[model samples]
Target: MSEAAVPDGRAAPTLTARQPKAVHSALTVLEAVARLGAGASAQDISRELGLPRATTYRLLNLLVQDEYLVRTPDLAGFALGAKVVQLATVAAPPARLASAARGVVAETRAALRGGVHVVFFAGGRLTVVDADPDFPLSDAVRLVREPERFAIGRLLLIDRGAADAAAVRDFAEFGATRQLGELAPAYGCVAVPILDGAGGFAGARGFSGSRPRADDPSDVLTVLRPAAARLGPLVV
Candidate 1:
C-alpha cells in the first residue's frame, strides 16, 4: 500500500499546549498593579480581577517572591519590581501602542507617504514607540534607545528652548495653538502634545515625510493635532 493510500494507524506527534488561563491570570495581576500606578493592595488586585481574596494574596506573594512584583516596606500593598521593568524593557512587545495608533498612523502615512512616529518622553529623552514602514525619510526611526537627536524630539522641544521652563511654556502655548515646523532640510515633521485627562502634557505625536512631498508645517499641524488629541487618554 502506498503511504498516502494506506490506512495504517500511527501515533500523532505530541505537542505541548500553553496554559492560557495561568498566563491570563498573571497578566491580569500585572495590569492591575500597573494601572494602580506604584502601589496596589491585595484587596485592590482581588477587586480588579474578581478573584478570591486568598487567591489574590497567594498570587501576589508568589509574584513578589519571584521579583516580578515588589511588596512595600509596610507590606500594605504591592507594586511592579525593577526586575519586571527590566524584563519588559527587553522582552515586552510594542503591540498595544502599535494597535492603538495604527489607524492614525496609517492615515498619516497614506496622506504623506512618509513615516509617522509616536514617541514618549522618558528619563529626559524621547523614545520612539511606533512608526510606519513606508516612511520616505531616513531610517533613523528604528533607533529606540534615545531620540534626543531626532527631529521629532527637537520639534517637540521647539517651544522649550530645548530644555528650559520658558521653552516648556512656549511648547504648551504652541500645543494649544497647534503650530508646525521643519526640523531638518530634507525632513519636516508635525508635532502635537498628547494631553492627559487632567490636561497635562503626556507626550508628543508626530508625522514625518520627505521634504519634497511634505506638506507645509502648518498643514502638518492641522493633520496631526486632532490625532494627538485623541491619543491623550491612551497615554497613561
Candidate 2:
C-alpha cells in the first residue's frame, strides 16, 4: 500500500488503489486455475495464487457467473468457460498451432517427469494453450502475473527485446531454468523456444517438474528440444 499526504499531515490511502489490485488478483486467480488444468479444486487456486480462501471463492463464483469459467459436471474442478473461448477466438493465433501440437505435447509431457505447457504470445500477453491436466507443475497465475520470472516468460521477453540488461545476462548464463523456491517454491520449470514456419520466434514449449537437486537445474532439453523440433515445422 502506498500513502499520500493529507492536509492534516497524516498518511492517507491512495484513491482506488485497492480496487484495481483486487481486479488484478481476481484475473490472476483465473490464470492459475487454467494452468492447473483438469480437475483443479478451489483450494488449489487459493494455494497457487496465495489468495485468501474467501477471495478465491468470490472470484471463482463471479467468473463462473459471467461464463468465463465452467465447473466440471462432478463439481471436482474448473475449465475455461464457453465465453472465455469465444473471447480467445478473436485473435487466437496459437489455436491452430496449439491443436496440432497436442499429441507431441502430451508425449513430451509423458516422457518427462512433470507437467508440460505450450505458451504463445498474443495481444501483448502470454497465453497457455495447453497443460498436462494430470500433473500440472506450477500454476498459470505465476506465468501470467510476472512472466519475466520464469524460463518461458523470460524467453518471450528476450525475444520481444523487452528484457533489461541484467535479465538478458542472467538468461544467457542460466538459460531457462526456474528452480523451485525461486518462483513457485513447490515446482521447477524449464523451457525451449519454438519457431514458426518462417523460422522466426513463434512461441515456447516447456515443462514444470519437481525441484531438482543443486546438481541439476530442471533440465528438460533432452525431451523438450526434440518436441520443439517435431512441432516447429508443423505450426505453419
Candidate 3:
C-alpha cells in the first residue's frame, strides 16, 4: 500500500485533546446534582462529580445561588429549585412534548397576553408541565393543585363528554380528537392534542387568556389548533 501524505506535508502528532474548563465544569456539576436528585449533600456531590471537595462546594454554592438548586430547611441536603422546575416544565425531553410545544405556547402568550399551559396526564393526575407568564391569574382564577378547578384540565376532560371517565381515558380521547375548547365564567382556554410519530397522542397544548377575551372558544381554537398541528408530528 502507498503511504498517504500528511496534511501540510507533516505527520500528525498523537496528543490528548484539552477539555474546555467552563463546559467541563458546568457539565460535571450538573451531572453531580442530577445524580443526587432530591437528596444530594455537598459531600455527596463532591464524590459523585469526582471533583475536589472545595471545588464541589464552590460549584454547588454557585448553583444554589443561581436558583438551579435549593438547600433544604435543615441545610443538610439539596433539591432542584423552582427555576429548574420552570426550565424542566418547558424543556423536558424523552417525553419531548414540552420542547415540541414551546413555540406554540410562546406564540399564544404573545397573542393573548395571558397564560399558556401544556398539561400532561400522568399517574392518574394532570400535571402542569409548562406554564407561561400569564398563568396563576393574580386577581381572577386562583391556582389549585387539582385539575377539577383548573380551566385547562377540566376543559380537556369535560368538553369531550368524558368528565366521569379516568384521566387516561380523557387523555386518550383528547389525543384522538386533536382539538377541544370550553368557556368558563372566570376564565377560558383552548387546547389541542399532540401526537407522536407513530400517530399516538402525546399530550395537550393550550392557551389560557382572559375569560372575556376568549369569549368564543372557536376564536381561540383557530389560533391554538394550527400551533398544535405544527407540534404534533414532532413530539417523538
Candidate 4:
C-alpha cells in the first residue's frame, strides 16, 4: 500500500525484486518434488534446487496450500497434487482414434451391457481416448488425477510394474483389474490391458456396471478380453 513519489510528482508503486525471486523459487521447488517422486523431503528439494533450507520449506508449504503439491501418505515428503494433473489434462489433448478404432469401440459398447471405455498410454500418462456417453465415468477428472482409484487407471499402473499388490492380484485373477463401488456408491468397474502388436502395453479397455457384476467379473472378462485384442492394433 506504500508508494514513492516520481520525479514529475506522480506516484509510483513500490515493488521489491524479491517478489519475482520468490516466484522462481516456488517453481523450482515444484520441479524438484516431481523429479524426486512421491516422497521428496524438504532437505532433498533444498539440495536439488540449491535453495536455502528456510526458503524451500516456505515454498513447499505455499504449493501444498494451493493444491499444487501434496504431502505423501507418511507425511514425510511431497508429490505432485491434483491441480497439476488437472492442468496437464487440460493442456494435453488425447490422441485421435481412427475410424477402425472407433468401430471397435462402438461394437464393444453394443455387445456390453454397461459403459465401455478406452484409454491409451502416451508419454507415460493415461489419456481417455473414448469415453462411453451412455454411461459416463463416475468422475473422469478424479480417474486421471488419482489413477489408483479406478480399475482402468490401475491397469496402466500395473503395466508400469508399480508396487500395487491389489492391482496385481486383480489382474491375475480376472485378467483385469476390478473396482467395486469405489468410484461411486453403487457402480463398479473392470479394466483389461490392451497390448500392441509387439505385445507391449498400449492401453486399457474398461467396463462399468452394477456392483454384483463388478464383484464377479468372470462373464465380463470373457467379452472384454477378445475386444481388447481386437482393439490393440487398431488403437496402436
Candidate 5:
C-alpha cells in the first residue's frame, strides 16, 4: 500500500493505492494451491495458509470461476488453470545458443531429413534454444502452451516424474519418445533426452517430420545421441 502524509502528521492511504486485503488474500490462496500441486483440497489449503476455512473456500470458488484454477478430474482438488499458463508462461522468448551449440545444431539439421530443434528445461519451464530455420516449428504456440502434446515437452515431464505411465515406459524401452500425428495430422516428432555428466536430464533434442519418420526413430536417435552429448556441456 502507498501512503500520504497529512498536515497533522497522520498517514492516509493514497487514492491510487493497489490491491487491498481481499485481493492479497486471494493471491495468497492461489500461491498455496500451486505449491500444493494437483489434488489440493480446500482443507489442505486452509491449513497451509492458516486462513479461515470459509475464506479459503470462497477464494477457491472465485478462482475457479475466473478460470485461474480448475478442479481435478474427481472434483476433489484443484490445479493451475489454462488462464495462468496463457498469462504467465506462454510464448517465452527463445534462448540464445553459444557458437559451439549453434554449430552442433547446424550439423545435426544437415544430417537429418526433418526439422531439428533444441529445448532447455529450467525453472520448471521449457525454452526453445533453437528451431530449424527451413522447417520452423509447426505450432510454436501450442508447443509452449500445451507441452504434453509434443515429444520434446514429454522429455521435460518425464524427468520431472509427472509424465504418464506410457511416456515413462517408452523412454525406458527406447531411450527416446515420439508423438505421431498428435500435434498435426500426418506430422510427428521424436525427441531424445540430453544428460549431463552426472547423468541427470539436461534437456532434449527433437526431430519432426512425417509420421513414418517418427514411427521409425532409430535413425533420428543415431544422429541426435552424439549431438546431445556434445550439447550437454555447452547448453547446461
Candidate 6:
C-alpha cells in the first residue's frame, strides 16, 4: 500500500496466495491422474480434480506429448508413461536400499492401489524398508506365520536352493503371484525381485490388493514389473 515501496509509483500488488494458479492447477491435475491410475479417462481426471473439460483435455494432451502420460492402446484412457517412471532413476540416494525406495514405494501404491512394500536384507535380518501406510498387508499375523503362501515370503526364500531358485526365477523375472493361504485368506500379492548392480538379489517389491481370483494376474504383473525395474538401479 506504500507508494514509496512501489516500483513505478503504483501501489505494490498484494499477494493473495502461495504458488501461481497455473502451477497449482498443473500439480493437482498430475496428482489426480496419478491416483486415478491407468485406464482413467480424461473425464475421470476432470471430475476428480474439479477441472474444466477443456482444461482437462489440454493438460492431458500436454502430459501425453511430454510422455508423462500415455494414451492406452484403445486411445480412450491414460496411464503413467516413461517420463514419469524416469523420476525413480533420480530418486535421492539413501544410506540403504530400503530408504532409497521410500518415494518410489509411494508412487507404486498410488498406481496399484494396494499395499506396496519394499524389503531388503540388512544385518542378517530381513527388514521392511518401506511400505504404503494406506495399504498394510491384509493379514500381518498370518503372513508371518505362513511365508510360503504369499509372494513376499516366497520371493524371500528365493536363495534357498538351485531347484527353488529355478522354480521362482521365472516368476520373479516376470512377477509372481501369491495364494490366499500363503499371505492372507482374503488377499494375495504379485511380486518381483529387485537386483543390485552386481546382479545379486537386493530386495523385493510388490502389491497386495484383491485376491487373485478378483484381479487379473497379468494386470498386477504389468504394474509391478516396471515398478521393480525402475527401482532396481536406484536401490542398487
Candidate 3, 1-236: lDDT as tens digits: 12445868975544334435745786677666655554568888887767788888887788878866667534776665545555544433323345545766677667656555666554344445565542532111122233444445554455444554443453454332211223234555555665556644455666665565444555566666677678666554
Q: Whose TM-score is higher: candidate 1's or candidate 4's?
A: 4
**The CA-based lDDT of model 3 is what?**
0.54
Compared with the true structure, all predictions reach lDDT values of 0.57, 0.68, 0.54, 0.80, 0.79, 0.62
Cα lDDT tens digits for candidate 5, 106-145:
9999999678988878766787667675565654435775
Expressed as tens digits, the lDDT of each residue in 77-152 for candidate 6 is 7766545544532343333455556667667778777678776633322345564445544433223334455566
The order of the candidates by TM-score, greatest first, is 4, 5, 2, 6, 1, 3
lDDT of 4: 0.80
Best by TM-score: 4
71: Cα error in model 5, Å: 38
Ranking by lDDT: 4, 5, 2, 6, 1, 3
**Model 6 stretches astray by more than 4 angstroms:** 1-100, 122-124, 139-146, 162-173, 181-183, 213-215
Model 3 shows how many backbone clashes? Answer: 0
Estimate the overall C-alpha local distance difference test score of candidate 2.
0.68
For model 3 the TM-score comes to: 0.43
- Please report how far candidate 4 places residue 192 from its true position, in Å: 0.5
The C-alpha stretches of model 1 lying farther than 4 A from their native spots are 1-95, 98-100, 136-148, 155-184, 212-215
Best by lDDT: 4
* lDDT tens readout by residue for model 2, 108-166: 87788576777776666777666555554243445665787677787778777887675
User: What's the TM for model 1?
Assistant: 0.45
Q: What's the CA error at residue 75 for candidate 3, in Å? A: 31
lDDT of 2 at 147: 80
Model 4 C-alpha lDDT per residue in residues 124-173, reported as the tens digit of each score: 68887777766655555567768888999998788778828988988887
Span of ten consecutive residues with least summed lDDT in model 5: 133-142
